[model samples]
Target: MTGPARGGADPGVAAAFRETMAAVCAPVAVMTGLEGGLPHGTTVSAFASLSMNPPMVLVALDRTSELLALVRRTRRFGLNLLGAGQAGLARRFAAKGGAAKFAGVAWEPHAGVPRIPGSAGFVGCTVAGLAHGGDHLIVLGNVVAAETTGDAPLVYHRRTFGTPAALPEVSG
Candidate 1:
């Protein structure tokens, strides 16, 4: 999808830079939510912790996404950290135009937010703040409650899904 063009960087150069950047980064999560009672989600690598004092986290959603609109209206959402085996669920939810994304996907409602079953972890949050950045909307959430199933997290890199090969050695 084309976002608003900035500066005069050659399109080819920009594309190459993006690819390189993606290669250097590791995927973290996919978030799921309901829009008008229909399941909606997207593969997002931009999820992160924003604060610990108030228990806040952030997920960046494309401004053009229908999910973003729903999030703005509903004010509640769920973050589902994908497990290594949940790649199919990620692709299914990321598909365009479908009401059956939730089909066969085990889930339960927590405070009106849909939480994915078998996810590595699930966080129920309310939209506490929003800010526009580039082509994305940074969604700041106030964590109301959370749970973990202690599963291996799915990783994405270089435009492909993967699992952690090994953990970094602890330093003394």
Candidate 2:
């Protein structure tokens, strides 16, 4: 692949960056928040644990995403970690604004936030801080409540959804 036009950054730099990040495996999640009393969510692979002392987590969202705006306005959100069998759910949220995103989906309000049922886990939090990143905003959340399931987590790599690889059992 070509580097860039001359020494300056090329227009294709953004595409290159996306291509690079696609190779880095990440967990699939559906971030949910309420807007005008309606449940809104989006698929996100940019979730990560930030701090353990106060129990904080971080998620990166596109600057222009409606979900980001909703979270900013509501100051509260839920992170539903998808399980291996929930690829369809992930795709639903990832799709452009659709009425079916929440229709018939199993979710309940917890701490005033919607938590999708049957996920690997869920985290309900309040926005603790925000930072500007190139083309994305970093949202930091202070965990108010969380729960986990025994299901294996959904994974994303190379622009595809998958389940994490299992390790072989070791004899003591």
Candidate 3:
């Protein structure tokens, strides 16, 4: 039998919502770009496939974020799916300030985009359009090139980083 769904209008509903959402696991990724010859990036879980026919993807960035401004002017960016061992790289890019997050981060150029080496996969794309969504900007991209290195991806769940283990096979 299934259990009854549980939800309520508590005073701390927003925090509870966030806590509950944090339990939903997602793959980690670092979105990078070059603005005025300086590298910039941020760790984001808001990346997803938008279309397969045109090979497009979408990433949401805070409207006020510096990275968003750079993407607006540059019109190109790269998405690097972090490997299970690249948590440090994710944290580095997540940090804000004058620190150079690209320092010591292995990368190469792909379709004029900085593709992070050793990632599970990378996609280089040019911005196709931008739309205002609430307090964020949804940037749609047209894929130019992509590559993979056969590494396991890092996952986020329950407000923490983790890797998924293979589950036992099930038979009908």
User: TM-score for every candidate vs. truth?
Assistant: 0.85, 0.88, 0.88
Worst 10 residues of 3 by lDDT: 1-10
lDDT of 1 by residue, 1-172 (tens): 4553576566778888898888865655657677666776667778888899999999988888877888899998888888989888777777776446667777777757777777898888999999988779999999998888878888878877888777789999
Q: Report the Cα lDDT for residue 1, model 2.
A: 72
Per-residue alpha-carbon lDDT of candidate 3 for residues 1-172, written as tens digits (9 for 90 to 100): 4333343345466567788889899889999888666677899998899999899999999888888888888999899999999888878888885228887777777777678878999989999999887668999999998888888889889868888999999999
- Ranking, lDDT, top scorer first: 2, 3, 1
Report every candidate's CA lDDT: 0.80, 0.90, 0.85
Candidate 3 local lDDT, residue 107: 74
Write the residue-wise lDDT of candidate 2 on 126-146 in tens digits: 999999877799999999998
Work out candidate 2's RMSD over C-alphas.
3.0
How does residue 74 of candidate 1 score in lDDT? 90
Better of 2 and 3 by lDDT: 2
Q: Please name the candidate that would achieve the greatest lDDT relative to the true structure.
A: 2
- In model 1, the worst 10-residue window by lDDT is 1-10
- In candidate 3, stretches whose alpha carbon ends up further than 4 angstroms from where it belongs are 1-11
